[model samples]
Target: MGLFPRYKRAARVAGAAILAALLAGCSGLGSKAPPPTYELMAVQSFPRGVGPIRGQLIVAEPSALALLDSDRIMVRLANGQTEQLANAQWEDRLPKLLQARIIQSFENGRRLRAVGKPGDRLVADYQLLIDVRAFQISADSNTADIEIAAKIVGDRSGRIRAARVFKVSVQTDSTEGPAAVAALNDAFNRAVVQLVLWTTRVI
Candidate 1:
């Protein structure tokens, strides 16, 4: 028929236009700005170590759910749904960042003769196991909540020594990226401070 070739030509033109649009969209995505990066907060100073530096600790990378494990900052809505905070991310994966900060906190506290990850090869007295339960801005981003369970196990005996959960909440002044993160930092600082105090007292 006379019309067949005409219809085929139009279809080719339309397909070409669609392909061009998709390529443009992909290019736009590739050109988008990178998200801002943030670091986890750590306790700066701690009460002087008691009698002597006795305990050696190995801080394991924390265990976390996939939802909380990503570098993306998360906010839990009042409706109990979670969403990533727009345009911001962590400097590293959540567990990795937290683990480093925890080691810093311990070293700063000076209660341990040595502290490091499993790779450190320290002749450790105890190993610290951590499980991250929640780390997010909650209640529609107006509050920061952090929770973690920690356990001390005898490195030589492979026996549990002590265990406890730590949790803290700090009210946010604003849900904006910087302020929200500040609040989270405050909460995390509080939690780690308590964790340090407890660890020193126990072992």
Candidate 2:
């Protein structure tokens, strides 16, 4: 009878150990690793131009829809619904990220006498107003599309001097996050190149 009680206790201990191991395994299986983060590439140097635009130019932060404003990488589905990529995210909020890149693009051109933001306190000749219409990857076709509307306004007059829309699309080689990001970068670079060229010409 004494041995029987010891055996029962031993059996209970073994059962508890087995249950604990099973629970740990289940927990490990349920948890998933987070996806990788990616950043937008800056256009370091633009093609040399005829001359720098006179006076300071302020590049305002681009306005975007709520969906495009986030750091999550967006994808447009065939069904017309927008979704985010599973394991990838942008380095920063989309608008702020694009604003920095645009500023960098202008700096790379070296064709602006002075480039700055709104708070720079520089006497501005013109302000670049940007509206981001679209910036997303297409899940169906595995492509990236970027569209931006740019307007140059005389700072003092507050009148729009020149306005144009820029759009570019680049096809991705694969459906993976890296491929989509690469395509997005290519499309964004193309748009920036065109935007800089046009701005320099008009302003």
Candidate 3:
């Protein structure tokens, strides 16, 4: 009878341990949550009066807007440390981002017949080729510096129509990454506004 009592107590303890383990397993099975997702922001502006530049193709780097490289050196937090932004998506890659910004600025200017990528079959009168050298927010990040070298070539004549390098800096107090992007965008906007005005006169 004494040995029977000890055996019963041992069985009870083992049963309790198994029940606790099962409950823990069930909790674990139900604990997972979905990962966060981000939707890219579409290029903003009106398409009204906007069409392919009469006879030109605007080609931009496809993956520039990605955290990935975009030929243009983007300003990043410098200390050999990186922090991922929560769930924000950008409109285009580096070159494409810059191209779209340029396109939109021109759209706002209400100039040009058509402005688009380079693959169309139409005979372009002028082609604007761009190489973005640096678009960076400085160490203080209070200002954004943008430098771009571009050439406008007459398609049929194959002559360098208008070639100019643009460098512009816009002041801002924003220290955030998105704010830095916005400042850079603003600088680009002003520079393109000037370039388009000049181009409209020349062409």
Candidate 4:
């Protein structure tokens, strides 16, 4: 009877040890660290041009496809498939991010008297509508491509005064997160500059 009790206690101790090890393994598996986050570099300024618009201009949030609307950094594979970078993300949704940057670009140019978004309560003279056609990095060639279509509508007339599509492709040395994002930023800046200049000229 003494031996039996001793054996029972030993078996219980072994079972507890096994349970602890299993719990530790499960914890380790669950504790996987997330990937790092990245943000699009904002445009500092565009070249100043003659002040073309003297009234408030409202910038709308650009529209994009479901895949392009997310914070994921997109990549186009050689096989023509689209995928996002592993463990990397954008600071904001693509449309919102671009809208803020476009407003900043106009501000930097100093060509407009005022610029704002939809809810700013600004009595706008014109509205800038944008559609994001392509904003992604090409994994096969290691390049960044940005395409945006812009339209300026007269607030009073409610008619589109001008429309244009701006496209830019910049070669990157690597498809890695940092390099690719840098390239995308450069391309975006170029596109924003063009859009700002064109909008000012037409509106």
Candidate 5:
């Protein structure tokens, strides 16, 4: 009985030591792990159209977000100090996001009979030309802002129906890439809403 008790105590001690080692290993591994992040991308869609139009609208998408070399700023790090990260590449390789926002705006207006890409088969009467001017995060504003120069042109008549530059600044609560994107998205939604209303009145 004495030998058995000693053996059981030794096993219990061994198990406790093993568990402690495992937990210690896990803590060290977990501490060095990075948070979740992703390569920011864009998406496009249309809304509020009843039926197709006589002509199709084409949207030209840009390939890269233009990072502003002169607009870099010191961002607050997790350590509570500050660090400088890249600036002004929000629209880079994100043409889909822009195209989607524009399409939704026009669709909401219900003025354009049809909307499509450049190669689409639908015959279009008016084409929308969009230039993303300043879609980036501003440290000065502590948020991201989106500015797009847009124009509506008659396809058959080759006349400029409407032209305007839309700009909006949005503040983000997070300091991560996703937070920055969310800010841009919010600004984009507002811009699209206003643009749709404007298009409805004019065309």
Candidate 6:
């Protein structure tokens, strides 16, 4: 028993919380609430009458580096340090979510003869390959950064037709769970729109 018994108790509680957080990553089983989850949606409307390009297209699962590959919502601190959004996460893996929404977007375009995933076992005329370059929000500012690279290749000939990279920035203003996800989804929709439009012209 020390003279400052209450101070000792507070220190012990704080230490325990830190330990729990370390073990559980950002979302701990401590008194704090569970982290919220977010998801990206496909753009509903695409340019119709896109000059009658017809082909079966398969969208591959996008490739991303370790930092942008996880379900965690990524953020870069003001000091250029990287961390996740402590209160939010993606509903699914980033790549999986991107692939699904992209497929949906192609279907929304309604110009393709067909759109399938690699697992669909369909003979496709062209394949749309995507790579995730950067997708993160800066904590210093409420701006989200997104960069994507894409390649269109002939499935039968195995020849590359076209390739391009896309970059988009969006100011979310609301930092936490409320508006951060909305901002990210907006950026994704816009970027994917371009990717779709470019693929239409190339293929």
Where model 3 places Cα greater than 4 Å from the true spot, the runs are: 1-68, 71-73, 76-89
lDDT of 3 by residue, 1-203 (tens): 68999999999999999999999999999986632332222234433434434334453333222444433234545563333432333443456666655666655555566665566664667777776665666654467776777777777777887878778999867645566566766786666766675665556
lDDT of 2 at 43: 82
The whole-model lDDT of each prediction reads 0.89, 0.89, 0.59, 0.87, 0.61, 0.87
Better model by TM-score, 4 or 5? 4
**lDDT computed for candidate 5:** 0.61
Query: Each prediction's TM-score against the native?
Result: 0.84, 0.82, 0.59, 0.84, 0.58, 0.81
Candidate number with the higher lDDT (4 or 5) = 4
In terms of lDDT, the poorest run of 10 residues in model 1 is 46-55
What TM-score quantifies how close candidate 3 is to the native fold? Answer: 0.59
Model 2 lDDT per residue over 11-96, tens place? 99999999999999999999988678898987877776776455578999999999998898898999999889778999899999
lDDT of each residue in 1-203, candidate 1, tens digit only: 99999999999999999999999999998897888998887899876666876788899999999998889889998888889988788899999999999999988888877999998879988889999999998866489999999999999999999999999989998765888889889999999999988876777
Over 4 Å off in model 1, which ranges? 1-30
* lDDT tens digits, residue span 1-203, model 6: 57599998999999999998798874544557668878789989976664775888999999999888889988888898888887899988999999999999988987778998997988899998899988888878788889999999999898999999999999998767868888888899899889888887777
**Candidate 6 regions with alpha-carbon error over 4 angstroms:** 1-33
In model 1, how large is the Cα lDDT of residue 124?
A: 88
Worst 10 residues of 4 by lDDT: 46-55
Error of 3 at 158 (Å): 2.4
lDDT over C-alpha atoms for residue 166 of model 5 = 81
CA displacement after TM-score superposition, residue 180 of candidate 1 (Å): 0.7
Each prediction's RMSD to truth? 5.9, 5.1, 8.3, 4.2, 9.1, 9.4
